[model samples]
Target: MADVVNSRSRSSSPSSLGATEFKFPEGLVAHRENLPAGRVTATTLDGTLTKAPLQLIEDLSNGCGGQLWPAGIRLAKYFISRYRNGDELTGKRVIELGSGGGVTGLAIGLELDQIGGDIDEGGCEFWMTDMQAMMELMEKNVSFNGLQERIRCGLLDWADPLPEFVARRPVDIVLAADCVYFEPAFPLLEKTLCDIAGPDTEVLFCFKKRRRADMRFIKSIRKRFVMTEIKDEIYARESIYL
Candidate 1:
């Protein structure tokens, strides 16, 4: 909802020396590249909660969905921060939409296994879904993190009907990041969310504010869902980014 960020300058007091260095959100690390295709390796993710580093191979030849994004990193870190409580993602069915690099989904699966959380049937069921073009990248990342058994990479088109993998079972949570960049895909994304997100479903979506059209997508989602802003240090600092 924040498109314009106010720029204010004020004198800092002599005692305002407690400011800390800015860093990416906790439980989040990404190695990106400018090349058309490359590998990304992140070794540390907020300590013991992460047993191993996550590696994602991005192939831009496929599409924009081949690279990582800030929203996905933030979502992964935020969700891991919350899941460490041991109650989250327990036997829950989670689907991440528009998973470009599959960072968020891969990280969740990694952390769940690191902490010995349930990932088998009757446990947390996680699926990383995107358009057909992103299926290969999604699968590679899942295998890179040794989570092939834990995470399922599915082809999900926003404009198409609900896939059997999704329609067969009710989704408990829907995770999306950087899914609002394309103007033409707005209605398709909206339709998918409405179809999958029942009254009991929870959607934790994060996106960078880029244009006026982004606000329109938010407004449309609000018409069907009770959307709320999650106040945090990361959300506050990143909200102003264009």
Candidate 2:
């Protein structure tokens, strides 16, 4: 993730034109006033951790209206639960693409941590990517959970080339949640997957079956990828790579 620090020091005068600062000793940040009213926990490379209340706004200028999808959340929870005890992706390099709220990436990191994995000890690394605006929230969420050292955030537009931005790393797993809604972007998403994924790489995608166009897009991609349903909850489909 791009490193940009926006904080106010305690020693600064109250009259300073800035918001109050709340810092996590582990490197996470939470503004209770901005977060939704509910229990929010994020699974990290260490363990499941409670989320701090903080407001997250979408960058409308970048084509994101800052909406959080329930289907994405469900898929993330499912991945954590299914792999929480299994050998899949344990201590491996992983990346989440188009991570609007970064729920899955955060959860995967936490689940590994909870299972006594070595990510917290620096044995693993997580890369979370999205547009610049959403990337901001992804960074805040990682810092909020004090997983700064384990998780890295970046801006990855699937419309662009992967080699240009992300260094060539043998990513073991790739994840995408609710990123296939737009018809025009489907080709780019497929191309991006082809560019970044290898034969041994596993890719997981979560999508809502609400739109007919979405179904069509999935059908087109199925010819190239072996897709298996991992969960079939209402309005969502969670699939694992072949």
Candidate 3:
């Protein structure tokens, strides 16, 4: 998988991205493979977000997104490193596309909570979106984090028009993780990303390349948006590969 933050796509130097403290069942090796099927419950982004860890439940009954993936962890940590105290996201409209278990967005809420008072008052609105099938798991995780009041979960099919909640205002930041896996859905993802991301919007896209076709999805969007790969500071980029 890869981590790309699209802000008009410049192929400059790989920016340094620090890692966060996390507790995984199988450590970093989990990303090289998929977890055994059934259900998984664990706390991720353990130390950084809050005193109580961000707990998540992974149920693959709906789709692969039901489980946590490398890009989600990387993107969440990268976001935390940059906006750990939650000041940058203040007043920004952030949305995570294809948020299977709402891991990334929920982790974000934990940071935004650092601002104190109601997160809504901070003018920072967060929406974790995915297909209808993933809503239950998403909502469950939101409740897991005690973030019901901080986040909103919605149905956002990439092939469909922007949901009313997202269409109502300008989306300042877009967080997408592991969205490039299925080649058949490339056009749909492209349309939706380009549709929602304005000239000034920031898009954080992270994915692990399961196949060469995933690069095709990347190329399709390069024409419209520049993709800059994030350089991981803790481990070599190759470490993410199996």
Candidate 4:
């Protein structure tokens, strides 16, 4: 299994403040509306190369428009860098949990095609999953990147049973970025991971490493999985070995 690593950085602005107080069913708090513009390179199934404009956040309630978080962009770039450097994930079956904007998983799918992998030839599958609302935006992002066929979107709440999804096939790798927040969801996340992770599976989790609550949750998970510090600088992201 390939080792998952992370890097962390503090947000210069106070945009993250509203995220803490908001709950899912209650709806997210409204903050800034500025969407950062950036270019993301995505590879298609035919080995064709293309670039797409990326946004920080996509509001599910208001037609997928919102500020794109900086952490998300960083995570996406990290995945692209790893995939480009010959990571084992090039053509492997991949599932991404908590795919906020679907950047990480989309990056993997794009890189796979660029490296001349076999997904287009029906050799692999990429599953991008998140909550129902997030999944809607994820699908839009997948379609926007022209990867509708190479990527599949679904709703996968870690707190619930995903027996039918797991029955499809054993996943080679599972990834999540900036997903650790709620204290109650930590154990459910672990249980979900345990359900999908085998001896040969690799899981990559990235977080900003802020807040005592987040740190405590990560510590608890470390007891169950082998935690490796990939890059322990500003954005403290780490990889988990099962």
Which segments of candidate 4 are over 4 A away from where they belong?
Answer: 1-57, 60-67, 85-87, 114-122, 232-242
Q: Candidate 2 — worst ten consecutive residues by lDDT sum?
A: 1-10
TM-score of 1: 0.80
Off by over 4 Å in 2: 1-65, 86-88, 114-122, 163-167, 233-242
Per TM-score, what order, best first?
1, 3, 4, 2
lDDT of 4 by residue, 1-242 (tens): 11111112123221222232111210111232332232222122112213433312344353232223334445555656666644455456777788766656665666555432355464556778877656666776676656777777777888788847654777787877767757788888888888888777888776654467777877887877787766634333222111
Error of 4 at 147 (Å): 1.1
| lDDT, residue 144, model 2 | 58
Question: Best by TM-score, which number?
Answer: 1
Following a full C-alpha superposition, what root-mean-square deviation does model 4 have from the true structure? 10.7
> By the TM-score metric, which is better: model 1 or model 2?
1
TM-score quality measure for candidate 4: 0.67
lDDT for residue 118 in candidate 2, whole number 0-100: 51
Cα RMSD (angstroms) for every candidate in the order listed = 10.8, 9.2, 10.2, 10.7
Instruction: Estimate TM-scores for all models.
Output: 0.80, 0.67, 0.79, 0.67
Q: Candidate 4's C-alpha lDDT?
A: 0.55
Give residue 48's error in model 3 in angstroms. 3.1
Per-residue lDDT for 109 in model 1?
79
Taking the tens digit of each residue's C-alpha lDDT, what string does model 1 give over 1-242? 21111111121221212322234442222233453464343433335235665555656778777765667766787788777765666677888899987877877778765322245545777889999988887887777667777788888899899999899878888999889889999999999999999879999998877789998989888999988887676565665221
Compared with the true structure, model 3 gives a TM-score of 0.79
Model 3: residues with Cα > 4 Å off, grouped in runs = 1-40, 114-121, 233-242
- What's the lDDT for all of these models? 0.70, 0.56, 0.69, 0.55
CA shift at 123, candidate 1, in angstroms? 1.2
